[model samples]
Target: MSNEDVDSRRRRFLTITTGLGVVGTGFAVAPFALSMAPSERAKAIGAPVEVDISKIKPGAMRTEEWRGKPVWILNRTPDMLKTLPQMDKRLVDPKSEVDTQQPAYATNETRSIKPEILVLVGLCTHLNCSPLAKLKRGGSEGMEGDWLGGFFCPCHGSKFDLAGRVFKNVPAPTNMVVPPHTYLSDSRILIGVDKNKKSKKSKAKA
Candidate 1:
Protein backbone atom coordinates (compact mmCIF):
# COMPACT_ATOMS: atom_id res chain seq x y z
CA MET A 1 0.00 0.00 0.00
CA SER A 2 1.17 3.59 -0.56
CA ASN A 3 2.51 5.50 2.52
CA GLU A 4 -0.42 7.95 2.52
CA ASP A 5 -2.95 5.12 2.27
CA VAL A 6 -1.17 3.17 5.04
CA ASP A 7 -1.17 6.24 7.30
CA SER A 8 -4.88 6.78 6.71
CA ARG A 9 -5.64 3.12 7.49
CA ARG A 10 -3.58 3.28 10.70
CA ARG A 11 -5.44 6.47 11.76
CA ARG A 12 -8.83 4.79 11.15
CA PHE A 13 -7.78 1.75 13.22
CA LEU A 14 -6.60 4.01 16.07
CA THR A 15 -9.89 5.96 16.10
CA ILE A 16 -11.96 2.77 16.19
CA THR A 17 -9.81 1.29 18.99
CA THR A 18 -10.01 4.52 21.06
CA GLY A 19 -13.79 4.63 20.61
CA LEU A 20 -14.13 1.05 21.84
CA GLY A 21 -11.88 1.80 24.82
CA VAL A 22 -14.06 4.75 25.87
CA VAL A 23 -17.22 2.69 25.44
CA GLY A 24 -15.71 -0.16 27.48
CA THR A 25 -14.76 2.19 30.33
CA GLY A 26 -18.24 3.70 30.36
CA PHE A 27 -19.86 0.23 30.60
CA ALA A 28 -17.49 -0.82 33.42
CA VAL A 29 -18.09 2.37 35.48
CA ALA A 30 -21.85 2.51 34.98
CA PRO A 31 -22.60 -0.65 36.94
CA PHE A 32 -20.24 0.33 39.75
CA ALA A 33 -21.73 3.81 40.09
CA LEU A 34 -25.23 2.39 40.09
CA SER A 35 -24.27 -0.18 42.76
CA MET A 36 -22.79 2.52 44.96
CA ALA A 37 -26.11 4.37 44.99
CA PRO A 38 -28.72 3.05 47.40
CA SER A 39 -31.41 0.68 46.20
CA GLU A 40 -35.16 1.27 46.56
CA ARG A 41 -35.45 -1.40 49.23
CA ALA A 42 -32.64 0.25 51.20
CA LYS A 43 -34.28 3.66 51.01
CA ALA A 44 -37.56 2.15 52.16
CA ILE A 45 -35.81 0.49 55.07
CA GLY A 46 -34.33 3.79 56.27
CA ALA A 47 -37.50 5.78 55.74
CA PRO A 48 -39.93 6.65 58.54
CA VAL A 49 -42.17 3.83 59.75
CA GLU A 50 -45.79 4.45 60.65
CA VAL A 51 -47.62 2.37 63.24
CA ASP A 52 -51.30 1.98 64.03
CA ILE A 53 -51.81 2.12 67.78
CA SER A 54 -55.60 1.76 67.91
CA LYS A 55 -55.71 -2.00 68.31
CA ILE A 56 -52.87 -2.24 70.83
CA LYS A 57 -55.37 -2.36 73.71
CA PRO A 58 -54.57 -0.92 77.11
CA GLY A 59 -51.93 -2.97 78.96
CA ALA A 60 -50.89 -4.53 75.63
CA MET A 61 -47.72 -3.88 73.65
CA ARG A 62 -46.97 -3.79 69.96
CA THR A 63 -43.64 -4.21 68.23
CA GLU A 64 -42.56 -2.67 64.93
CA GLU A 65 -39.33 -2.40 62.96
CA TRP A 66 -37.61 0.86 61.98
CA ARG A 67 -34.13 1.06 60.41
CA GLY A 68 -33.73 -2.63 61.19
CA LYS A 69 -34.25 -2.07 64.94
CA PRO A 70 -37.26 -3.11 66.96
CA VAL A 71 -39.53 -0.26 68.13
CA TRP A 72 -41.99 -1.00 70.89
CA ILE A 73 -45.32 0.69 71.59
CA LEU A 74 -47.03 0.01 74.87
CA ASN A 75 -50.56 1.14 75.72
CA ARG A 76 -50.22 1.67 79.44
CA THR A 77 -53.08 1.05 81.77
CA PRO A 78 -53.71 3.48 84.64
CA ASP A 79 -51.95 1.01 86.92
CA MET A 80 -48.92 0.93 84.65
CA LEU A 81 -48.73 4.71 84.75
CA LYS A 82 -48.77 4.56 88.54
CA THR A 83 -45.84 2.12 88.58
CA LEU A 84 -43.49 4.68 86.97
CA PRO A 85 -43.24 7.13 89.88
CA GLN A 86 -43.16 4.32 92.42
CA MET A 87 -39.93 2.97 90.86
CA ASP A 88 -38.29 6.37 90.33
CA LYS A 89 -36.00 5.84 93.32
CA ARG A 90 -34.67 2.63 91.80
CA LEU A 91 -34.14 3.98 88.26
CA VAL A 92 -30.81 5.15 86.81
CA ASP A 93 -32.41 7.94 84.78
CA PRO A 94 -36.01 8.14 85.92
CA LYS A 95 -36.60 11.51 84.28
CA SER A 96 -34.91 10.56 80.99
CA GLU A 97 -32.19 13.12 81.71
CA VAL A 98 -29.82 11.69 79.07
CA ASP A 99 -30.68 13.96 76.13
CA THR A 100 -29.35 11.53 73.56
CA GLN A 101 -31.63 8.76 74.78
CA GLN A 102 -34.82 10.51 73.62
CA PRO A 103 -36.18 13.64 71.97
CA ALA A 104 -36.85 16.82 73.92
CA TYR A 105 -40.58 16.25 73.89
CA ALA A 106 -40.14 12.77 75.30
CA THR A 107 -37.89 13.81 78.19
CA ASN A 108 -40.58 13.31 80.79
CA GLU A 109 -41.59 10.94 83.53
CA THR A 110 -43.10 8.50 81.03
CA ARG A 111 -40.56 9.27 78.27
CA SER A 112 -43.47 9.59 75.87
CA ILE A 113 -45.70 12.20 74.24
CA LYS A 114 -48.78 10.63 75.76
CA PRO A 115 -48.63 9.54 79.36
CA GLU A 116 -50.50 6.34 78.62
CA ILE A 117 -48.55 5.29 75.55
CA LEU A 118 -44.86 4.47 75.82
CA VAL A 119 -42.52 4.11 72.86
CA LEU A 120 -38.95 2.89 72.92
CA VAL A 121 -36.29 1.16 70.92
CA GLY A 122 -36.20 -2.40 72.23
CA LEU A 123 -32.41 -2.95 72.15
CA CYS A 124 -30.55 -3.05 75.45
CA THR A 125 -28.27 -0.03 75.86
CA HIS A 126 -25.51 -2.12 77.48
CA LEU A 127 -25.09 -4.52 74.64
CA ASN A 128 -27.54 -4.47 71.62
CA CYS A 129 -29.37 -7.56 72.87
CA SER A 130 -33.18 -7.61 72.71
CA PRO A 131 -34.66 -7.80 76.18
CA LEU A 132 -37.52 -10.03 77.17
CA ALA A 133 -40.71 -8.09 77.92
CA LYS A 134 -41.70 -8.99 81.44
CA LEU A 135 -44.81 -6.82 81.41
CA LYS A 136 -46.56 -8.56 84.25
CA ARG A 137 -45.75 -7.56 87.84
CA GLY A 138 -43.83 -9.76 90.29
CA GLY A 139 -41.70 -12.81 89.42
CA SER A 140 -43.82 -14.14 86.61
CA GLU A 141 -41.16 -13.52 83.95
CA GLY A 142 -38.16 -14.83 85.90
CA MET A 143 -37.78 -11.54 87.74
CA GLU A 144 -37.25 -10.86 91.44
CA GLY A 145 -40.18 -10.64 93.80
CA ASP A 146 -40.19 -6.86 93.63
CA TRP A 147 -39.99 -6.67 89.86
CA LEU A 148 -42.71 -4.26 88.65
CA GLY A 149 -43.11 -5.42 85.06
CA GLY A 150 -40.65 -4.09 82.50
CA PHE A 151 -37.88 -5.59 80.40
CA PHE A 152 -35.13 -8.01 81.42
CA CYS A 153 -32.05 -8.59 79.31
CA PRO A 154 -30.95 -12.17 79.71
CA CYS A 155 -27.62 -11.42 78.01
CA HIS A 156 -26.21 -9.49 80.99
CA GLY A 157 -29.00 -9.25 83.58
CA SER A 158 -30.04 -5.67 82.88
CA LYS A 159 -33.39 -4.50 84.20
CA PHE A 160 -35.56 -1.70 82.77
CA ASP A 161 -38.82 -0.35 84.07
CA LEU A 162 -42.02 -0.27 82.00
CA ALA A 163 -41.09 3.21 80.88
CA GLY A 164 -37.71 1.94 79.60
CA ARG A 165 -35.78 3.58 82.43
CA VAL A 166 -32.61 1.67 83.26
CA PHE A 167 -32.67 0.36 86.79
CA LYS A 168 -29.96 1.40 89.23
CA ASN A 169 -26.94 -0.91 89.26
CA VAL A 170 -27.72 -2.42 85.83
CA PRO A 171 -25.36 -3.11 82.97
CA ALA A 172 -27.09 -0.49 80.85
CA PRO A 173 -25.58 2.89 81.64
CA THR A 174 -28.62 4.87 80.45
CA ASN A 175 -32.27 4.54 79.58
CA MET A 176 -33.23 2.68 76.41
CA VAL A 177 -33.43 4.95 73.37
CA VAL A 178 -36.78 6.46 72.47
CA PRO A 179 -36.65 7.10 68.73
CA PRO A 180 -37.98 10.40 67.34
CA HIS A 181 -41.68 10.02 66.70
CA THR A 182 -45.01 11.84 66.29
CA TYR A 183 -48.62 10.95 66.59
CA LEU A 184 -50.33 11.51 63.22
CA SER A 185 -53.70 10.96 64.86
CA ASP A 186 -55.13 9.36 67.94
CA SER A 187 -54.70 5.97 66.28
CA ARG A 188 -51.56 6.44 64.15
CA ILE A 189 -47.97 7.23 65.01
CA LEU A 190 -45.09 8.02 62.68
CA ILE A 191 -41.60 6.98 63.88
CA GLY A 192 -38.20 8.35 62.85
CA VAL A 193 -39.41 11.95 62.60
CA ASP A 194 -39.81 14.55 65.31
CA LYS A 195 -43.31 15.77 66.08
CA ASN A 196 -42.52 19.43 65.88
CA LYS A 197 -40.55 19.03 62.69
CA LYS A 198 -43.33 17.09 61.07
CA SER A 199 -45.77 19.80 61.96
CA LYS A 200 -43.49 22.41 60.41
CA LYS A 201 -43.21 20.37 57.24
CA SER A 202 -46.96 20.05 57.06
CA LYS A 203 -47.31 23.80 57.34
CA ALA A 204 -44.69 24.35 54.63
CA LYS A 205 -46.46 21.97 52.29
CA ALA A 206 -49.73 23.77 52.83
Candidate 2:
Protein backbone atom coordinates (compact mmCIF):
# COMPACT_ATOMS: atom_id res chain seq x y z
CA MET A 1 0.00 0.00 0.00
CA SER A 2 1.17 3.55 -0.66
CA ASN A 3 2.30 5.68 2.35
CA GLU A 4 -0.41 8.17 1.48
CA ASP A 5 -3.10 5.46 1.59
CA VAL A 6 -1.82 4.21 4.97
CA ASP A 7 -1.84 7.77 6.38
CA SER A 8 -5.37 8.35 5.08
CA ARG A 9 -6.64 5.15 6.77
CA ARG A 10 -4.92 6.14 10.05
CA ARG A 11 -6.55 9.58 9.93
CA ARG A 12 -9.99 8.04 9.27
CA PHE A 13 -9.50 5.63 12.21
CA LEU A 14 -8.52 8.52 14.53
CA THR A 15 -11.57 10.56 13.48
CA ILE A 16 -13.97 7.70 14.09
CA THR A 17 -12.40 6.91 17.46
CA THR A 18 -12.61 10.56 18.55
CA GLY A 19 -16.27 10.79 17.53
CA LEU A 20 -17.14 7.62 19.45
CA GLY A 21 -15.32 8.92 22.54
CA VAL A 22 -17.25 12.18 22.38
CA VAL A 23 -20.58 10.34 22.11
CA GLY A 24 -19.67 8.10 25.05
CA THR A 25 -18.65 11.07 27.22
CA GLY A 26 -21.98 12.81 26.50
CA PHE A 27 -23.90 9.69 27.47
CA ALA A 28 -21.97 9.39 30.72
CA VAL A 29 -22.41 13.08 31.69
CA ALA A 30 -26.12 13.26 30.78
CA PRO A 31 -27.26 11.06 33.68
CA PHE A 32 -25.13 12.98 36.16
CA ALA A 33 -26.67 16.24 35.00
CA LEU A 34 -30.15 14.80 35.33
CA SER A 35 -29.41 13.50 38.83
CA MET A 36 -28.18 16.94 39.87
CA ALA A 37 -31.55 18.47 38.96
CA PRO A 38 -34.18 18.67 41.66
CA SER A 39 -36.62 15.78 41.89
CA GLU A 40 -40.40 16.18 41.82
CA ARG A 41 -40.62 15.28 45.51
CA ALA A 42 -38.00 17.87 46.40
CA LYS A 43 -39.83 20.56 44.47
CA ALA A 44 -43.12 19.60 46.10
CA ILE A 45 -41.54 19.85 49.50
CA GLY A 46 -40.15 23.39 49.22
CA ALA A 47 -41.53 25.12 46.15
CA PRO A 48 -44.28 27.73 46.24
CA VAL A 49 -47.73 26.43 45.32
CA GLU A 50 -50.28 28.35 43.33
CA VAL A 51 -53.87 27.70 44.32
CA ASP A 52 -57.03 28.26 42.30
CA ILE A 53 -59.66 29.75 44.61
CA SER A 54 -62.43 30.21 42.03
CA LYS A 55 -63.85 26.74 42.58
CA ILE A 56 -64.09 27.18 46.34
CA LYS A 57 -67.52 28.53 47.11
CA PRO A 58 -68.29 30.74 50.09
CA GLY A 59 -68.50 28.80 53.34
CA ALA A 60 -66.33 26.05 51.86
CA MET A 61 -62.65 25.23 52.17
CA ARG A 62 -59.92 23.57 50.13
CA THR A 63 -56.69 22.01 51.31
CA GLU A 64 -53.28 21.99 49.68
CA GLU A 65 -49.95 20.53 50.73
CA TRP A 66 -46.72 22.47 51.29
CA ARG A 67 -43.60 21.21 52.98
CA GLY A 68 -45.48 18.00 53.85
CA LYS A 69 -48.04 19.95 55.90
CA PRO A 70 -51.64 20.67 55.00
CA VAL A 71 -52.63 24.25 54.29
CA TRP A 72 -56.27 25.31 54.36
CA ILE A 73 -57.95 28.00 52.32
CA LEU A 74 -61.31 28.92 53.76
CA ASN A 75 -63.82 31.12 52.01
CA ARG A 76 -65.75 32.58 54.88
CA THR A 77 -69.32 33.61 54.39
CA PRO A 78 -70.66 36.86 55.87
CA ASP A 79 -72.18 34.94 58.71
CA MET A 80 -68.92 33.15 59.39
CA LEU A 81 -67.06 36.44 59.62
CA LYS A 82 -69.62 37.79 62.07
CA THR A 83 -68.81 34.93 64.38
CA LEU A 84 -65.15 35.92 64.68
CA PRO A 85 -65.69 38.91 66.92
CA GLN A 86 -68.15 37.07 69.11
CA MET A 87 -65.56 34.42 69.83
CA ASP A 88 -62.86 36.95 70.71
CA LYS A 89 -63.62 36.96 74.42
CA ARG A 90 -63.54 33.19 74.30
CA LEU A 91 -60.28 32.87 72.37
CA VAL A 92 -56.68 32.91 73.50
CA ASP A 93 -55.43 34.97 70.56
CA PRO A 94 -58.48 36.57 69.05
CA LYS A 95 -56.54 39.47 67.60
CA SER A 96 -53.64 37.28 66.49
CA GLU A 97 -51.29 38.99 68.94
CA VAL A 98 -48.68 36.29 68.54
CA ASP A 99 -46.58 37.84 65.82
CA THR A 100 -44.78 34.60 65.13
CA GLN A 101 -47.95 32.87 64.03
CA GLN A 102 -48.58 35.15 61.07
CA PRO A 103 -47.15 37.92 58.96
CA ALA A 104 -47.63 41.58 59.93
CA TYR A 105 -50.38 42.11 57.38
CA ALA A 106 -52.37 39.14 58.70
CA THR A 107 -52.32 40.21 62.35
CA ASN A 108 -55.85 41.49 62.21
CA GLU A 109 -59.29 40.45 63.35
CA THR A 110 -59.71 38.15 60.35
CA ARG A 111 -56.13 36.85 60.45
CA SER A 112 -55.96 37.09 56.68
CA ILE A 113 -55.03 39.36 53.81
CA LYS A 114 -58.71 39.53 52.85
CA PRO A 115 -61.54 39.49 55.33
CA GLU A 116 -63.46 36.79 53.48
CA ILE A 117 -60.66 34.47 52.51
CA LEU A 118 -58.53 32.87 55.22
CA VAL A 119 -55.35 30.86 54.71
CA LEU A 120 -53.92 28.84 57.57
CA VAL A 121 -51.59 25.98 58.24
CA GLY A 122 -53.82 23.10 59.37
CA LEU A 123 -51.51 21.77 62.06
CA CYS A 124 -52.36 22.40 65.70
CA THR A 125 -49.84 24.59 67.49
CA HIS A 126 -49.51 22.15 70.38
CA LEU A 127 -48.79 18.80 68.76
CA ASN A 128 -48.74 19.45 65.02
CA CYS A 129 -51.91 17.38 64.67
CA SER A 130 -54.15 18.25 61.76
CA PRO A 131 -57.44 19.74 62.86
CA LEU A 132 -60.87 18.82 61.53
CA ALA A 133 -62.89 21.54 59.88
CA LYS A 134 -65.89 22.11 62.06
CA LEU A 135 -67.09 24.93 59.89
CA LYS A 136 -70.74 24.83 60.85
CA ARG A 137 -72.15 26.70 63.77
CA GLY A 138 -74.31 25.68 66.76
CA GLY A 139 -72.79 22.31 67.54
CA SER A 140 -73.21 20.93 64.03
CA GLU A 141 -69.79 19.35 64.42
CA GLY A 142 -70.47 18.07 67.98
CA MET A 143 -69.41 21.08 70.04
CA GLU A 144 -71.45 23.25 72.38
CA GLY A 145 -74.73 24.65 71.09
CA ASP A 146 -73.19 28.10 70.64
CA TRP A 147 -70.23 26.83 68.69
CA LEU A 148 -69.22 29.16 65.89
CA GLY A 149 -67.54 27.89 62.73
CA GLY A 150 -64.01 26.65 63.46
CA PHE A 151 -61.70 23.66 63.63
CA PHE A 152 -61.67 20.82 66.14
CA CYS A 153 -58.58 18.78 66.87
CA PRO A 154 -59.75 15.36 67.99
CA CYS A 155 -56.23 14.28 68.86
CA HIS A 156 -56.12 16.47 71.98
CA GLY A 157 -59.47 18.27 71.88
CA SER A 158 -57.96 21.61 70.92
CA LYS A 159 -60.46 24.05 69.45
CA PHE A 160 -59.84 26.91 67.02
CA ASP A 161 -62.33 29.50 65.97
CA LEU A 162 -63.20 30.82 62.51
CA ALA A 163 -59.95 32.78 62.31
CA GLY A 164 -57.84 29.86 63.55
CA ARG A 165 -57.64 31.52 66.96
CA VAL A 166 -57.22 29.05 69.76
CA PHE A 167 -59.96 28.86 72.35
CA LYS A 168 -59.14 30.14 75.83
CA ASN A 169 -58.93 26.64 77.29
CA VAL A 170 -57.60 24.61 74.38
CA PRO A 171 -54.49 22.52 74.43
CA ALA A 172 -52.99 24.55 71.62
CA PRO A 173 -51.19 27.68 72.82
CA THR A 174 -51.44 29.94 69.80
CA ASN A 175 -53.56 30.51 66.74
CA MET A 176 -52.98 28.40 63.66
CA VAL A 177 -50.16 29.76 61.52
CA VAL A 178 -51.02 31.88 58.56
CA PRO A 179 -48.41 31.02 55.95
CA PRO A 180 -46.82 33.79 53.93
CA HIS A 181 -48.90 34.23 50.79
CA THR A 182 -49.97 36.74 48.19
CA TYR A 183 -52.83 37.09 45.76
CA LEU A 184 -51.79 36.60 42.16
CA SER A 185 -55.22 37.63 40.98
CA ASP A 186 -58.80 37.69 42.16
CA SER A 187 -58.95 33.93 41.84
CA ARG A 188 -55.39 32.83 42.35
CA ILE A 189 -53.02 32.82 45.32
CA LEU A 190 -49.35 31.95 45.62
CA ILE A 191 -48.32 30.35 48.88
CA GLY A 192 -44.85 30.47 50.46
CA VAL A 193 -44.30 34.14 49.59
CA ASP A 194 -45.02 37.28 51.55
CA LYS A 195 -47.55 39.78 50.28
CA ASN A 196 -46.12 43.06 49.06
CA LYS A 197 -46.31 45.29 52.09
CA LYS A 198 -45.08 48.23 50.06
CA SER A 199 -48.00 48.06 47.70
CA LYS A 200 -50.39 47.72 50.57
CA LYS A 201 -48.87 50.74 52.21
CA SER A 202 -49.03 52.75 49.01
CA LYS A 203 -52.67 51.88 48.58
CA ALA A 204 -53.35 52.84 52.14
CA LYS A 205 -51.57 56.13 51.62
CA ALA A 206 -53.62 56.83 48.52
Candidate 3:
Protein backbone atom coordinates (compact mmCIF):
# COMPACT_ATOMS: atom_id res chain seq x y z
CA MET A 1 0.00 0.00 0.00
CA SER A 2 1.06 3.58 -0.63
CA ASN A 3 2.10 5.77 2.30
CA GLU A 4 -1.13 7.81 2.08
CA ASP A 5 -3.20 4.64 1.99
CA VAL A 6 -1.32 3.31 5.02
CA ASP A 7 -1.93 6.57 6.84
CA SER A 8 -5.65 6.48 6.06
CA ARG A 9 -5.96 2.88 7.22
CA ARG A 10 -4.04 3.77 10.38
CA ARG A 11 -6.43 6.63 11.01
CA ARG A 12 -9.43 4.36 10.54
CA PHE A 13 -7.88 1.82 12.92
CA LEU A 14 -7.34 4.52 15.50
CA THR A 15 -10.92 5.73 15.10
CA ILE A 16 -12.37 2.23 15.47
CA THR A 17 -10.14 1.50 18.43
CA THR A 18 -11.26 4.66 20.16
CA GLY A 19 -14.89 4.06 19.31
CA LEU A 20 -14.81 0.43 20.48
CA GLY A 21 -12.75 1.05 23.61
CA VAL A 22 -10.24 -1.61 22.53
CA VAL A 23 -7.38 -0.22 24.62
CA GLY A 24 -5.67 -2.62 27.07
CA THR A 25 -7.68 -5.57 25.79
CA GLY A 26 -6.45 -8.83 24.32
CA PHE A 27 -6.86 -8.86 20.54
CA ALA A 28 -8.87 -11.57 18.80
CA VAL A 29 -7.41 -12.29 15.36
CA ALA A 30 -9.88 -14.83 13.93
CA PRO A 31 -12.91 -12.55 13.61
CA PHE A 32 -10.78 -9.67 12.32
CA ALA A 33 -9.22 -11.97 9.69
CA LEU A 34 -12.64 -13.37 8.73
CA SER A 35 -13.96 -9.87 8.11
CA MET A 36 -11.31 -9.31 5.41
CA ALA A 37 -12.73 -11.39 2.61
CA PRO A 38 -11.48 -12.58 -0.77
CA SER A 39 -12.89 -9.61 -2.68
CA GLU A 40 -13.36 -5.97 -1.82
CA ARG A 41 -16.61 -5.77 -3.76
CA ALA A 42 -18.10 -8.64 -1.77
CA LYS A 43 -16.80 -7.18 1.45
CA ALA A 44 -18.33 -3.83 0.55
CA ILE A 45 -21.77 -5.40 0.22
CA GLY A 46 -21.85 -7.15 3.61
CA ALA A 47 -19.81 -7.00 6.82
CA PRO A 48 -20.78 -8.52 10.14
CA VAL A 49 -21.78 -5.96 12.74
CA GLU A 50 -23.11 -6.17 16.31
CA VAL A 51 -25.02 -3.19 17.65
CA ASP A 52 -26.62 -2.38 21.00
CA ILE A 53 -29.82 -0.53 20.19
CA SER A 54 -31.31 -0.11 23.69
CA LYS A 55 -30.75 3.65 23.75
CA ILE A 56 -32.91 4.76 20.81
CA LYS A 57 -36.28 6.23 21.83
CA PRO A 58 -39.62 6.03 20.09
CA GLY A 59 -39.91 8.24 16.96
CA ALA A 60 -36.11 8.55 16.78
CA MET A 61 -33.40 7.23 14.45
CA ARG A 62 -29.89 6.00 15.14
CA THR A 63 -27.04 5.63 12.63
CA GLU A 64 -24.54 2.80 12.72
CA GLU A 65 -21.64 1.75 10.49
CA TRP A 66 -21.55 -1.54 8.62
CA ARG A 67 -19.15 -2.39 5.79
CA GLY A 68 -17.88 1.19 6.00
CA LYS A 69 -21.34 2.47 5.14
CA PRO A 70 -24.12 4.02 7.20
CA VAL A 71 -27.03 1.86 8.39
CA TRP A 72 -30.10 3.45 9.95
CA ILE A 73 -32.21 2.07 12.78
CA LEU A 74 -35.48 3.90 13.21
CA ASN A 75 -38.01 3.67 16.01
CA ARG A 76 -41.32 4.41 14.38
CA THR A 77 -44.41 5.61 16.16
CA PRO A 78 -47.81 3.88 15.85
CA ASP A 79 -48.96 6.62 13.53
CA MET A 80 -45.91 6.09 11.32
CA LEU A 81 -46.75 2.38 11.02
CA LYS A 82 -50.29 3.28 10.02
CA THR A 83 -49.01 5.58 7.25
CA LEU A 84 -47.09 2.82 5.40
CA PRO A 85 -49.96 0.85 3.80
CA GLN A 86 -51.89 4.03 3.12
CA MET A 87 -48.85 5.23 1.09
CA ASP A 88 -48.91 2.21 -1.28
CA LYS A 89 -50.59 3.96 -4.20
CA ARG A 90 -48.37 7.03 -3.80
CA LEU A 91 -45.03 5.18 -3.78
CA VAL A 92 -43.15 3.68 -6.71
CA ASP A 93 -42.30 0.32 -5.12
CA PRO A 94 -44.82 0.26 -2.34
CA LYS A 95 -45.21 -3.52 -2.08
CA SER A 96 -41.45 -3.88 -1.65
CA GLU A 97 -41.39 -6.68 -4.28
CA VAL A 98 -38.07 -5.25 -5.46
CA ASP A 99 -35.59 -8.00 -4.56
CA THR A 100 -32.52 -5.80 -4.73
CA GLN A 101 -33.54 -3.68 -1.76
CA GLN A 102 -34.14 -6.26 0.97
CA PRO A 103 -34.13 -9.95 1.90
CA ALA A 104 -37.27 -12.11 1.67
CA TYR A 105 -37.61 -12.35 5.44
CA ALA A 106 -37.67 -8.56 5.63
CA THR A 107 -40.20 -8.13 2.78
CA ASN A 108 -43.18 -7.29 4.95
CA GLU A 109 -45.42 -4.50 6.23
CA THR A 110 -42.71 -3.04 8.49
CA ARG A 111 -39.82 -4.11 6.21
CA SER A 112 -38.02 -5.61 9.17
CA ILE A 113 -37.78 -8.60 11.51
CA LYS A 114 -39.51 -6.50 14.12
CA PRO A 115 -42.31 -4.04 13.50
CA GLU A 116 -41.95 -0.48 14.85
CA ILE A 117 -38.21 -0.70 14.14
CA LEU A 118 -36.90 -0.24 10.59
CA VAL A 119 -33.34 -1.03 9.58
CA LEU A 120 -32.04 0.17 6.23
CA VAL A 121 -28.83 1.26 4.54
CA GLY A 122 -28.95 5.05 4.49
CA LEU A 123 -27.55 5.51 0.93
CA CYS A 124 -29.84 6.84 -1.73
CA THR A 125 -30.55 4.54 -4.68
CA HIS A 126 -30.45 7.51 -7.09
CA LEU A 127 -26.66 7.92 -7.07
CA ASN A 128 -25.49 6.42 -3.76
CA CYS A 129 -25.96 9.70 -1.88
CA SER A 130 -26.92 9.79 1.79
CA PRO A 131 -30.50 10.94 2.34
CA LEU A 132 -31.34 13.32 5.14
CA ALA A 133 -33.95 12.23 7.68
CA LYS A 134 -37.13 14.32 7.35
CA LEU A 135 -39.38 12.84 10.02
CA LYS A 136 -42.25 15.31 10.01
CA ARG A 137 -45.74 15.36 8.54
CA GLY A 138 -46.61 17.06 5.21
CA GLY A 139 -43.10 16.79 3.70
CA SER A 140 -42.18 19.69 1.35
CA GLU A 141 -45.88 20.54 0.46
CA GLY A 142 -45.44 19.82 -3.24
CA MET A 143 -45.84 16.05 -2.78
CA GLU A 144 -49.50 16.55 -1.85
CA GLY A 145 -51.58 15.23 1.10
CA ASP A 146 -50.41 14.18 4.55
CA TRP A 147 -46.74 13.12 4.16
CA LEU A 148 -46.33 11.38 7.55
CA GLY A 149 -42.48 11.04 7.52
CA GLY A 150 -39.41 9.77 5.57
CA PHE A 151 -36.01 10.59 4.00
CA PHE A 152 -35.09 13.13 1.32
CA CYS A 153 -32.00 12.79 -0.86
CA PRO A 154 -30.41 16.17 -1.47
CA CYS A 155 -28.43 15.09 -4.54
CA HIS A 156 -31.29 14.56 -7.01
CA GLY A 157 -34.53 15.36 -5.17
CA SER A 158 -35.36 11.73 -4.41
CA LYS A 159 -37.93 11.26 -1.65
CA PHE A 160 -38.55 8.14 0.45
CA ASP A 161 -41.30 7.55 2.95
CA LEU A 162 -41.04 6.11 6.49
CA ALA A 163 -40.80 2.65 4.95
CA GLY A 164 -37.93 3.86 2.73
CA ARG A 165 -40.09 3.41 -0.34
CA VAL A 166 -39.07 5.86 -3.05
CA PHE A 167 -41.64 8.31 -4.36
CA LYS A 168 -42.79 8.32 -7.97
CA ASN A 169 -40.84 10.61 -10.39
CA VAL A 170 -37.92 10.77 -7.97
CA PRO A 171 -34.29 10.22 -8.98
CA ALA A 172 -34.10 6.96 -7.05
CA PRO A 173 -35.54 4.00 -8.94
CA THR A 174 -36.03 1.80 -5.87
CA ASN A 175 -36.17 1.81 -2.07
CA MET A 176 -33.03 2.07 0.02
CA VAL A 177 -31.35 -1.32 0.45
CA VAL A 178 -31.92 -3.34 3.65
CA PRO A 179 -28.85 -5.26 4.66
CA PRO A 180 -29.26 -8.79 6.11
CA HIS A 181 -29.84 -8.82 9.86
CA THR A 182 -31.38 -10.71 12.80
CA TYR A 183 -32.66 -9.71 16.21
CA LEU A 184 -30.74 -11.51 18.97
CA SER A 185 -33.28 -10.21 21.47
CA ASP A 186 -35.83 -7.48 22.05
CA SER A 187 -33.01 -5.01 22.73
CA ARG A 188 -30.08 -6.46 20.75
CA ILE A 189 -29.72 -6.86 17.00
CA LEU A 190 -26.95 -8.41 14.96
CA ILE A 191 -26.62 -6.78 11.55
CA GLY A 192 -25.04 -8.67 8.63
CA VAL A 193 -26.08 -12.01 10.21
CA ASP A 194 -28.93 -14.00 8.72
CA LYS A 195 -31.49 -16.50 10.07
CA ASN A 196 -29.81 -19.53 8.49
CA LYS A 197 -26.66 -19.00 10.55
CA LYS A 198 -28.76 -18.76 13.67
CA SER A 199 -30.34 -22.11 12.89
CA LYS A 200 -26.97 -23.71 12.26
CA LYS A 201 -25.58 -22.36 15.51
CA SER A 202 -28.66 -23.57 17.34
CA LYS A 203 -28.31 -27.08 15.86
CA ALA A 204 -24.67 -27.24 16.91
CA LYS A 205 -25.60 -26.42 20.48
CA ALA A 206 -28.36 -29.04 20.44
Best by TM-score: 1
Measured against the true structure, the TM-scores of the candidates, in listed sequence, are 0.76, 0.75, 0.73
Better lDDT candidate (1, 3): 1
Model 3: per-residue lDDT, tens digit, 139-166?
A: 3744434767888888989989898888
Q: Which residue pairs of candidate 1 clash?
A: none
On lDDT, the leading prediction is: 1
Give the distance in Å from residue 173's predicted Cα in candidate 3 to where it truly belongs: 0.6
Which digits, one per residue and each the tens of the lDDT, describe model 2 over residues 25-139? 2122232333455675455456677788898899999887666578899999999999987887898877787656468867889988889999999999989999999999887
lDDT of 1 by residue, 138-194 (tens): 887778899888999999999999989899997899899989989899998988889
Task: Indicate whether candidate 2 or candidate 3 has the larger lDDT.
Answer: 2
Q: In model 2, which range of ten residues has the least summed lDDT?
A: 24-33
- Residue 13 lDDT in candidate 3: 79
lDDT of each: 0.82, 0.81, 0.77
RMSD of every prediction: 14.6, 14.4, 6.3
Q: lDDT of model 1 at residue 120?
A: 91
